[model samples]
Target chain A: MPKLINKNTVITNPWTVMKASTGPEILQVVPGKNFIVPLQFWKLYQEELNEYDGNIAVWLDSDENPEQISDELHSLPLIALNFPVFSDGRSYTNARELRQKYAFKGEIRAIGDVLRDQLYYMAQCGFDTFEIRHDQEAELCLQAFNDFETGYQSTVAEPVPLFRRR
Target chain B: MYRYDGYDHQMLADRVAQFRDQTNRYIDGKLSEIEFLPLRLQNGLYVQRLAPMLRIAVPYGMLSSTQLRKLAYIANHYDKGYAHFTTRQNIQYNWPALVDVPDLLADLAEVEMHAIQTSGNCIRNTTTDQFAGAAPDELEDSRAYCEIIRQWSSFHPEFAYLPRKFKIAVCGTVDDQAATQVHDIGIYIVKGDNDEIGFRILVGGGLGRTPVIGKEIFDFVEKKHLLTALEAILRVYNREGRRDNKYKARIKILVKETGVEEFKNKVTKEWALIKDSSLTLTDEEIDRCQKFFDAPNYQELSNTPTQLTDKLQSNILFAAWHSQNVKPHKVTGYSIVTVCFKETGVAPGDVTDRQLEQIADLSDEYSFGEIRISHKQNIVMADVRQDQLFELWKALESGAMASNNLGLLTDLICCPGGDFCALANAKSIPIAEAIQRKFDDHEELTNIGEMNLNISGCMNACGHHHVGNIGILGVDKKGEEYYQVSLGGSSKNNASLGKIIGPSFAQEEIPDVVETIVGVYKEKRIGEEKFIDTYNRIGIDPFKEKVYAKAD
Candidate 1:
């Protein structure tokens, strides 16, 4: 399990990503079964506000209009989006816009192709939680977030503009 | 020659510290290769086929003697004791280790330099005329404006992650030595009818697989609103530039898709919102930047030196060099000397550490402790006294820097081909060597007059081969290297891409092909007419017939 850092707090990430399985053990949105809402599911089930709980995480496409999601649903406790590939940085912008512009104050997580190099940028863009691949060492990737103590530009994490810094 | 102010210094120092931390995290296994790639690239670090290539920005090609020495030191201590000058007027070290880059940047920062925005999808180092303040035709020093743009674009929040990398070039002279027309944005500073100076803006010009001449957006942009206007253009590009395809992502594609009129309307609509904002320049700030580039104190002397005249009449090599490599400066008795890098058997822009140190010393002694790297891949000592020509030439000769082939056939602008670059389709260095060998005689070269022969390893056009008078493109056919030839292309005020002459030939046949083209020019040219003018008058058919005669 990867250690998730929010502000100064560090805790073990609770989500378990498993390959597709069939039967009662499939775990379709059980009480404790943390689930990631795919783009298709978010589009289909977003209207049925009562179906999903605060614990249900939803994935949002970078190009999708964030306004489509009801503001009340933003109070969900967890959310994770797919990065798709190393070069597909749209997810970072999506994560940032969701947190800063839309004011979604929940635990935004990064999933799929999320590598160590992007940890700092992802954190700056307001992703507090991360679900890295099972094959990678999550502890080492977590340390990469603070690689640079100072940045020349302001980000969502650091709202103070560069010019305002002494 | 923009001096570093407090803010500029602070920004660079902070960026260096930030990159240092990034490097530490990568080394500590905290960052994965995918995560760190963009951050490292934005800092001008690239993993080439052989080793990590670090590109240090030389803002507008102007450098102080102190900066040059630091570069020399870095080259000697870190890399293979040599550095390659890039077409973008920056220097690239071909063999810097990933671990030592932060330290290398710290060395650079001591001289007020950094590698920020040198790569990635960001505003790149702005290039301008090397002879900015020294050129006789210059209306104002373009380097001052280039510095202003550099300051404005450095770590700009909005434009950092554009659709593709952006480049801008400024030229103050009518001659257009900076190759302005081929940049993403080309700004030409001109004096208005009211005796005030402003800019003529050309947007969407670029050279690559697809070459397009920039269309003029504004005849005169008031000097004060320069930054605001630039901001508007960048905003539009950031919002609408294509992201689906890398090749079609440049601003040119957007401009072409939405015709020039519509594009102009969009820019105008955006500009009206912020035209009078704080981004607009004040006269006080412009004058302050101008102060750093104030002309050096010059002693009045006769334009022609008696000793130089006597030497020129006696020594043919000296006479040839003086005619080809030296240009008349705005100051009397001082000349701008171009040290050509297009030497035979050497890569076009490769200079050793010893050569760099020597040039730094020469700049201190002869010039004003300043040097400029020309877009044609040559170095210019912009303030050499006429009396010191012989001594300077002698010093240059020791290091093979006095090539006397500036603007000649041997002065080829070539990219590092298959030998170093993974993207190259074929090798380009051997073809350049063959042509250089073919035109070895100084007297013959002098007679041939000013000519530009450019070669690219691939269609990426890193060498700016499209604008060469005689352009050579290396193409691969079943793993064999073949060269395509073009004619009459230029990058000056009347900028035009070259026209291909017919079929491609094997590498060995390129020198002979070049020789035959030169022969045609020699046969048909009018008195004092250049190879370009002659080819332009007679058309490509004559040369095409001669070159492809045996093949046909």
Candidate 2:
């Protein structure tokens, strides 16, 4: 199981990422279990998920745009942004859009290909939780937050640019 | 020069510490090579053919004397006793041990320099005209905006992992010295209707396997909205740029495929949402950045001092160098002096550690302790006093830094090709040397004045071959190396990509091919018209016909 950092603290992960549906089939959700389903799955089965879930969240692939589910953002507890590869950073934009453009107040979690070196930047892009890759040590990744105390640009963490703040 | 305040210094130190940890992790088998590739590359470390090449970012080609000394120290201690200045106005160490890069970066941090975003798929250095603040035709200083872009792009969270590397250039003068039109995004500082300054943004311009002249996306973007506009474009690109093929991944490909109008519409839509956000620049912040680039103290001296006039009359060599290498500065008494790195037999842009130190000292003594690197891979002492021209020339001559080939055919821009780069198809420095040797005659070179002959080892166009008036691209023909020559490209305000002259040539035939092209230019010349102007008037057919006719 991948250890998770939630709100800058290491915590036991309760969410299970469900297998993505390939076709038009809607995935059935098991009751009383926290689950993170694919965006397509949530779009197809949100009505069913509303009645039978302990906690249901949607995960977006790197190519998926947050605006696709912008109307439903207020209802979701968390939105997991996937990094198919560590360097494919489209999800970073998705996270920024979810937090900034749509003004989504839910927890924005970073999942898949997440690692220690990327945590500070991921956080700056508005990700509050990280489902770090299982091969890495999560406890050690905590120090990544303290890697840079400040950034130059107007990031999600700092709304104003450094020059303005100065 | 932009001094690093406490925040800037702390951020650099933090970045150094983080990179040190990343390096240690990579060495300890905790981070795989695949995982560490982008991490190391974004930090400007490239494992080349011989060893790791570390590129140090000279922000907008502006370097302080302190930074120059530190670069010299790094080159001497960590790598070979010399470094290469790239066409992007960055300095690259051709040989540095992988283990020592972190230490070198730390040393750089002490001088407020770093290798951050010098390479990799993110936004690289934001360059500007080497004569930005000093050029006579200047509208406004573009370096301040370049500094703003530098700070914004540094470790940008969302854009750091772009599909391909991006370059932005800011041009403040009428003459596009920074080669703005060939960059990923070109920002030309233009005056508005009310005489207020704004930006003219061009997108999708780049040189690589497929070179494209950037199209104007926004005719005018207001001053405060510059960063917001940039963010909108970058965000759109980040979400939409192609990732399937590395060659097709640059924003140029996307802009070309999407059509500039449609791309502009998307950016406009995105900008509407974020234009008034906290990213908007305040007048105070803009003024703060502008203050750093304010003109140095100057004594009101004559534009052409009697000593300079006497030297020009008495010394032929100094006259030649002054004619070719010096430009009019905005200030009456000052002149911009280009220190030529294209001395014959030496690799273009390669400077010895001693020369780097010497240039540093010269910058201090002659140019107010500031040095600027032109994108043409030469150094510039941008504020030299007219009265001290002769003395400065003597100092430069003593150190062999006074090569009188500033825009001449022999002063070609050549990349560290197959000799050092892992991506090069063939060697470029040898071909450049061969051409330089053939055109060693000063009178003949002067006759074929203001030529841009650029050579690239591959289609990556690091040497900017695509925009050269005479471009040589080294192509891998099966197992053998062949050179393809292109004609009529210019990186000026009216920039265009070069057209291939004909079929490729053998390595030995490059010098002859270039000479034949020049011979045609001389024959077809109409009363001292420049090479590019002549080529444009007569087209490539005449030169192509002659070169192939000789072969036949």
Candidate 3:
């Protein structure tokens, strides 16, 4: 099983991704088990999400808006942003908007195509849990964070730049 | 030049360390080549056709003598004993082993320099006019804001990855020497109605596949709100730019698809959110950035030196060099001297370690121990004293660095095409050499006058063929190379893309076609109208008729 990483430490991955399904073939999300469903499913099956007694987590596509689902953050265990491919990076700014403006308190996870080189930037933009590809070594991904110790811009983790601190 | 503080030093040092680890990881089979590509690119290492080419950023084209010497040291030690200066004001070492790039980064860090953002699909190095601080007509010194943006954009977590590479050019001069109109983001510094200086923000302008002049989104953004406004634009592009097709991925396509007005509205909404944020430029921060770019201690020479005037009257070559290479400076008795890299037979912008060393010496002796790499791919000693110009010219001639062609036809802007670049469809340097040889006569070239001849191997437009007055694009037809000629492109204040005259030509036909174009212009031109103005008035038919008829 692939483990999630938060600040270079391995943790249990609690969410299962459910891609879009046809009519009457919707996923049977279990109660008390965190599940990550596409944004389309959340809108179509709002009744089901409300009926569930457990936590809900939604993964937003590159073009999707976080503002649509930010109101439901009180009950979510995680808000995962999807990077469909390695080159697609709209999720980076989306992650920043969620943390900086929306004040999201739950775990913000980066999933799909996540690699070791991008971990330092992911962490800086307020992502706590990274869903590394099942093919990647989770232990090796941790080393990416130790390399870059300084940053020029103010991120969610820091309110001011290093120049201001200096 | 902006001096690196302890924080800046630490940040660059940490990047070297990070890149080193990333390099080792890839070598150990821990990271795939696909996964490692962006990482290496962010460090300015490109796996080229021959070997890796490392492009190092020379921010705003300003480099101290110390920094240049270190570049020379790196060139001599790593890969070839030379470096190529790029149109974007970056220095590229065309050959380096991938294994040694991390070590190279470490050495560059010792000089407070790094290859960060030089090649990645991120906000690359911000370029300004080479005479940013020295130009007489400039409304403000733009290097201050460039330095600020450099800091804000460096290691920017959000913009570390973009759909395509983004470039920004800033110019404070009345004449757009930095080609601001053709950049992804062109910041034109100007005075507002109230005499307060601000930037005229332009977006979506680029040259690659579909060349479009950027549209202005704002007449004037206050200096304090500069960073805030830019952050909004970048956020909009980052979120909405196309990711499906790499060719259609630049912010230009997004702006064109969404329309500038709608794109402006999106950016306006984003700017509203961050207007009062910490990214807003405070007076202290602004002053701090500006202090680093303060002019050097210029000697108080009120009048032109008699010795220089005498030399100009006595020597014809010196007079010719002075007429073409010397530009008027804001500070009295100090002139901007352009040292040409476009020697007749040599590859444009390629300078050896010995030339770099010689230039370092020249900078110390003539200018204020400073140098600049222009967008036109030449070096400039922007603050050279008028009295010292004669001596400097003689010294430059001794080093074979003195060429009296600044904007002439032979002074061609060229790309490292098929010979070096992997994307090039054909070789560009040979074409440039051919054209220079055709127009080799000094007096004849002078008589022809003020033409921008540019060559590119492909539509990528690295040579900025789109804006060249007389542009050449090399196309491959059935495994053979052919050249297409375009006319009337300009990158000045009134910038426009070139128009294809007619069919393409063979390698041997380029010079003859160019000569025919010039010949037609000379015959039909009214008074002193240039080739561009003549083409604009009489249209391409006359030149087309002359060339095609000859070819047939």
Candidate 4:
């Protein structure tokens, strides 16, 4: 069980990450299974949203248009996007637009190469949780989020602008 | 130089303490290596091939004698007794223990200096002309704006984690000595027709794997809205810059993709919102900042000193040095003395601790305790009196700083390559040294006349290889070093990136290639035309023919 620290409180992480029974939960999507939802999964099961609900996560390619997905799918429990590398900050924009413009309010998480340095930034972009790799220390990644004492600009979490601050 | 007020001092002190705590936590196993990486990088600590390298910001290359002495002390005490002056006018210590870095930060804070934003993907030290305040034909002193930007960008919350490192440079004079064109944001402080000071803002310029000359965003950005306009530009970049691919993340790439007009519009829209805010510069604040850089009390004397004439007539060496290492200062009696770092048989920009101390002494004795590091990897004492020129030259000569190759072939801007830097693909110092060795004779160098050869280890182009009249770039082929040559580049007012001649050549053949290029220049030149003018006239065909003829 991982202890999750939100913006102001520490609580038990409710989402059960899937993995091989023998390996770390961070390594697998779900127990003994890789729950990958294809583009067609959203289209084919548009009306059966509650039927397929479980401890599963969704992934999207950069080429995939978010507008094509049904509005109902936005209420999913977990969604993780891949960051190819440190230099590719396109996903950051996508993440921000998805949360701010599209209003995808569910648990939007980052999956790949989500290094510790990017935790604070990812959080600012409205990622409530991060599905960091098994090799990475989750506890350390969490600490990186709180590393800076002050931020000069407002984001989704803190709407009061930097200039307005006393 | 921007003096640190109470707020600035407190921020720097807090930053140092924060870094110290982060370092302790990492060592105590509370923070992982991955987690601690950005924290350390933000503090200007980079783990290099040999040891951790810490780059200390000498804002706009201006330093007091006290600051230089502190740097000398740090260089001697903590690491090697040598520091390399970077193209951005920052000083990089090659070998500092990671554990002692916090202490180094503490030491730096004592001198009102810190390594903050020197590394990581943030706005770096805002560079300006080394002769910002003193240069003739100046519209406004650029250091005042540089200081304001420094304060505004210091640990800026929104921009701390930029998609890529951002660099800004301001040039006040007509001459683009700061290489403003290649920065992320290049601001030219110019007076409008109405005699109001404003900036001609250029955005998305940078030198790296992909070299780009910035495009003009604003023809006349008013003095009041400078900060707000800059904020708007940054906001647009923060919101829209490419993060998926590292190579394509620079604002240049954004400008290229979005087109300058569209990018300008986006910035304008963002600016419209923030322009009337607190970030807008007021006349009072601007005037206050400008007061500090008010011109020194210059005494007028004859340009030609009787003693100088005697020295020049008697000593040819002194004459050559004077011709090359000294520039015409705005004041009649004073001259800007360029202390060349490009000495033969020595790595360019590497100044020993002893040399730094001597420089500090010279600055105090001759130039009102102020020294400047030029973009050309040299130091400048901007206010050297005509009468004290001989004494200054004599002292510099004793310290091995009086290299009579200020703008000559030997005055190469060479980067630390495989010998020290981990990012380098091939060694650059050896190539620079080889060329220096070939052109060692003072008379021969003077005859070649006013050449600028810039060498970079890799495509990252830290040496400003793109804008050199003669550029040498080191490339790797099958684990072996090869050098590529380019010509006709210039970073002055008419700035342009170099054009590569052709294929890469073996390391040993670079000197001959350079000679052939010079040979072509000499043969085609009309009445003491420079290498750039010669290259421009004859084009690269003749040089290419001579350089590659022996290859096949």
Q: Give RMSD to native, each candidate.
A: 4.7, 1.3, 1.6, 5.5
lDDT of 3 by residue, A16-58 (tens): 8766563313435345555688888877888877776656678
Tens-place lDDT per residue, model 2, A1-166, is 7789964678888888876754323334345878888998888876777776478888999988988887877898888999988889898889888888899998888888998888888999999999899897867798899999899998888888898889
**Most DockQ-accurate candidate:** 2
lDDT of 2 by residue, B54-80 (tens): 999999999999889988898899987
DockQ of candidate 4 relative to the true structure: 0.13
**Reference-based lDDT, residue A68, model 2:** 88
Model 1 chain B is weakest, by summed lDDT over 10 consecutive residues, at B273-282
Residue B7 miss distance in model 2 (angstroms)? 0.2
TM-score result, candidate 2: 0.98
Model 4 misplaced regions, further than 4 Å: A1-166, B300-302, B550-552
Q: Whole-model Cα lDDT per candidate? A: 0.81, 0.91, 0.88, 0.80
Which scores higher on lDDT, 1 or 2? 2
Give model 3's TM-score versus the native structure: 0.97
Model 3's number of clashes is 0
Ranking according to DockQ, highest score first: 2, 3, 4, 1
- Candidate 3 chain B: minimum summed lDDT over ten consecutive residues — where? B274-283
| Interface RMSD, per-candidate values to 1 decimal | 5.0, 0.7, 1.3, 4.7
Instruction: Encode model 3's per-residue lDDT on B26-113: one tens digit a residue.
Output: 9998878988898889889998999989999999898878888889999999968999989899999988898988888888888788
Q: What is the C-alpha lDDT profile of model 4 across B365-403, one tens digit per residue? A: 999999999888899999989888898999988987888
For candidate 2 chain B, the 10 contiguous residues with the lowest summed lDDT are: B46-55
Q: lDDT of candidate 3?
A: 0.88
Query: Which number leads on TM-score?
Result: 2
